[model samples]
Target: MQFENTREFARQLDKEDKLSRYRHEFIFPKVNGKEVIYFVGNSLGLQPRSAKKYVDEIMKDWAELAVEGHFYADKPWWDYHERFSEKLAKVVGANPSEVTVMNTLTVNLHLLMVSFYRPSGKRYKIICEEKAFPSDQYMINSQVRFHGYDPEDAIVEIKRREGENNFRTEDILQKIQEVGEECALLLIGGVNYYTGQVFDMETITKAGHDVGAFVGWDLAHAAGNIELKLSEWNVDFAAWCSYKYMNSGPGNASGCFINKKYHNKKDIPRFEGWWGHNKERRFLMEPEFHPEPTADAWQISNAPILALAPYLASLEMFDEVGMPALIQKRNKIVAYLEYVLQEIDKDVESTFEIITPAEQEDRGTQLSVFLHGEGRELFNYLMEQGVITDWREPNVIRLAPAPFYCSFEDMYEFGQILKKGILSKQKV
Candidate 1:
């Protein structure tokens, strides 16, 4: 499809878009009395209009029922997090029994590591991507330290080829093979936060397993933005935050996927609490912990009802629209965004080099552009003009055109604004 940098073309595309109407479901921020074209869904999603209703329901229940709300509220606060299992399983392509909602992303990762990241005398090293999200780096480093190992020896980072912006699948596979028996675990972000590259999880998971290593993914960016089949991939475990593409509020609850093979295992070690106990026998309060025979076995505490409320609200929308529809729009819109960037670059003296993978399958909704011959002034101009985007160090701006709310018109308008910002700088 030929993409044109014109309002009419953008409007025509939006008119044909089946997902266009869903944009109204969200509330956007204003800059100078107009709704901004939001491009930072990779950072934080816009608030779902239904989020307040979800939260208010919980608030009303707490007011009316007091402590009894745990058992009698409309959602039943004691089992609130259970509501996410079915819907979230669909989103991440896992069985309902294999999925659960619990603590925040990094926290869940830490908890999951208790079971998946076991290291022994001869096999203690972990393989991860080079320059992983800072939080992940910190988590891995701390986990290794807690296990009494130096990060320098225990962490094997798969570096990108010297001058490349992304990791090659062969390089990743080769590194996994090289790590061999020493590799206790192989975990990497499903969607790279920096270059927006989508790794080949199925193949990588198989490679990890073949090498006698546990494999998992940090799906912070991949959970709702790209296609995932955690169970089919035979991933041992995975975790993702709901506040990004999932459209839950800030620092909201996270979703986890644990393979059914790991369920009800007596040998598997985990950090457990009352919520993970058998529901029918939980009130008994026996001293021994009998974990629930599913992913909930990883739960360390009771569900945070208020936090899960907005997440449930967003999951309902995902169920209604389905991932196939979202991915369809995502592919077209991201391509159109790339086309707009190219067209705008042609008009301006500055060059916009999209560091993200060119193939649709190798990328998701985000395009990380290397703004050559430009600086922070352009980013500031964009922000002031209500173009909400994310700025990384060294003149890179991450633009994620979230399919549910972002529109083709936003892409075209952003191109215009970008051209103006660049030309304005040249005149100075």
Candidate 2:
């Protein structure tokens, strides 16, 4: 699709977009009574208009039903989480029984590591990418220490080659093979947070399995942003936060996937809670833990209904639109954004370089631009001009054109503002 750096061309594209109607379903933040050009959905998605309505329903149920809300409320708090499994299963490409809504991402990662990251004898090393999310890094380090192994000896970080900004799939596979005998677990981000690179999960999962290691993913950045097939890819486990691409409110409940192959395995140890007990005998208060034969066996506590309400609201939209439709619009809009950025790069000899992979299949909606020499001053300029973007430390600015609500016009305006910001800095 050819792109033109003109407002009229953007307007034409917006007019033709079938998903444009979704923009009205979200409430955008305002600056001086005008809506800002929001491009931060890759970090925190815009709240759906239906979120308040869904949350209020839960509040009303709690007010009226009180303790009995556990069984008698409209949605029944006792099993409120059961409502999301089917829908979320579809979102992550898993069977309903393979998915469960539970704790936050990092917490779930720890819980899964308990079962999947077991190291025995000489096979105690864990392989992960360099510069994983800090939370994941800390969790892996602490878990390694918990097993009485030094992190320096037990962890192998797959790094980019000199001067390269991304990892090659072949290099990652070779690394897995190189440490085959010592590797106990292979944990990686499905989509890297810093570079927005979507890893080849299927190939990586196969490589780990071929080497006799458990493989899992932290899908915090991939869940609602890119296409995933946890089951088909044979991913042993995965976890993701709901706030980013899923548009749940900040710090809301997260979703987890445990392959059905492990659902009935009694030998797999987990941090058990009463909620994971068999529903039929759960109220009996049995001293023995009879775990559910589903992903629910990993739940360590009761679901937080209020916190999950907004996520349900957003999932309804996903259910209505389907991921295929969303991905369709995503490709075109992201292409438009890339084209706009490239046009700016050419037109102004821009000081920034786009570090994100150029291929649509290798990335999602986000593009990380590394400023050659400038700092946050240009980012501040864009913020003052009503373009809300995400800034990383040092000199990177991330712009995401979310398919759910972001418009082509938004991308065009961002390019215009970015050009102005660059030219203005040059005049300085």
lDDT values for all models:
0.94, 0.91
Estimate, for each residue in 1-428, the C-alpha lDDT of model 2 and write its tens digit: 67898999999999999999999999999976889999888889999999999999989988888999899988898889998888899899999999999989999999999999999999999999999999999999999999999999999999899999889999999999999989999999999899899999999999999999999999999988899899899999999999999999988888999999998788998999999998889899999999998999998788888998899999999999989888888889888888888888886755568889988899987888897877789899999989999999889988887899999899998889889888888887
Worst 10 residues of 2 by lDDT: 345-354
State, as a TM-score between 0 and 1, how close model 1 is to the true structure: 0.99
Clashing pairs in 1: none
Q: Compose the digit string of candidate 1's lDDT tens values, residues 1-428.
A: 87778999999999999999999999999999999999999989999999999999999999999999999988899888888889999999999999999989999999999999999988999999999999999999999999999999999999999889999999999999998999999999999999999999999999999999999999999999999998889999999999999999999998999999999999999999999999889989899998899899888898888898988888999999999999999999999999999988888888889999999999999999999998898899999999999999999999999999999999999989989889988998
The alpha-carbon deviation from the true structure for residue 311 of candidate 2, after best TM-score superposition, in angstroms, is 0.7
On the 0 to 100 scale, the lDDT of residue 321 in model 1 is: 96
- Total residue pair clashes for candidate 1: 0
For residue 189, what is the lDDT in candidate 2? 94
